[model samples]
Target: MKADETIVNGVRIGGAETKVGEDIRTIELPSGARAEVRKGYGRDLMRAQRAAANGDASAVVFALIAEVTRVDGHKIVYEDVLEMDLADVMALQAEVIDENFDRPPQRASQASSNPDSQSEH
Candidate 1:
């Protein structure tokens, strides 16, 4: 494989997803463990959530953030982690999304509160 070329198994996703490069940052949580964060765009995040809805790919894709690996670990170096526990992933997700994990950042839909605007009731 060429150094410039990357290979990912399964899931034919990410022709455009890769365009949004990661913003790498090393964060040390209150626990003292350093996390090497690799933040991607909202599109990728939605894709992962969708995958999780379909099958086992949820824990792998969403929690680990692509690249098949174990889900459990203390030091998350972006890719070195194997299995991110519930607590760990939750905490990281908050930090990853700037604590805006409540929902993806998008324009909120406006609602007309005036009942009279509805016309003949």
Candidate 2:
């Protein structure tokens, strides 16, 4: 996959690529852990595109943000395969945009409201 290319549930992700299908599956983690993951489609892709267009990072980053947790007695469970924490990606993209575009510094209030503020400090 390309650096900016992302694949989730066998669906290709990009600014122009959308239309995901219901393709969920169970897979083993690098630690030999297993979990069931769901596949997201159309709506998910549109949201990802909006995020990317709104100075958010590429969809690839979002697609890679997997949820992995170990249950006490049961095997690890993974959900929301196409789900991404938009706040995280937005913050990263904001910083890059600011640096490249040389945008003015944001006020305390604006910075505080930003989920990526923690990284800025």
Candidate 3:
């Protein structure tokens, strides 16, 4: 596999040829272990939310991590993520949440083109 590529659930992803959302991102943790995370879809988020009962926010984030993250190419459970070190967990959370949840700021021209795109803030 190329340096920019990663294998998630035994499927190869990333590289220059891949499309935007199909790319995989590699994160190196404080423990010296690397995790491969993929951009999650709506179904993945729904599954993670269901896994987190009682509407617990932290549980939902952790569940999302488990749903999209693979350490050393091995799948991990939510409990396994909870057992990780704080730094590693933060790193995982940043990568997973940013890639899946964070939206880039719209350019001035693009935002002006659509009145509905105005910032709520």
Candidate 4:
């Protein structure tokens, strides 16, 4: 394989190397395997929740991981995560949950404008 080409899930993708950006982050497992996780949006969360319907919190989290993570540059589905070692899965879960769900909600003022701004009369 050439330096610019990568085989992800047995399919080759050739291009410039991808760098981690504000929207994407990397998680390294104890086994030296790495997962590239992207920040998921509300739709991704809703899809994950639906996929884990009636399942426990862990199931939902796993589904979310599947929704947002790529291992070896390949999308790792829920079943792939399930087949992983416990420690690796836990590492992925922690990173995925922290990146996607654990952050405090952004205040409306923080998102749009200053909280102390006065309204026009």
Would you estimate the TM-scores of all the predictions?
Answer: 0.38, 0.27, 0.67, 0.64
Cand. 4 Cα-lDDT = 0.74
Instruction: Identify the candidate with maximal lDDT.
Output: 3
Name the better of 3 and 4 by TM-score: 3
C-alpha RMSD of each candidate structure in angstroms: 7.9, 15.5, 9.7, 9.2
- Model 2 lDDT tens row, 24-100: 35444433445333444345445445444554554433432322111122321112323424453344334323332
Give the per-residue Cα lDDT of candidate 3 at 85: 97
Question: Candidate 4 residues 6-111, lDDT tens each?
Answer: 6644533344334456488887888888888888778667766776778778888888888788888776666787898999988988888788767677677653
**So what's the TM-score on candidate 2?**
0.27
Ranking by lDDT: 3, 4, 1, 2
Sorting all predicted structures by TM-score, with the top scorer first, yields 3, 4, 1, 2
Per residue, candidate 3 scores C-alpha lDDT tens digits across 14-110 of 3443246676898899999989888787766776777676679999999889878888977676788999999999999999988988888867696
- Residue 55 in candidate 1 has what lDDT? 55
Clashes of each: 7, 0, 0, 0
Clashes of 1: 7
Provide the lDDT at 34 for model 2: 50
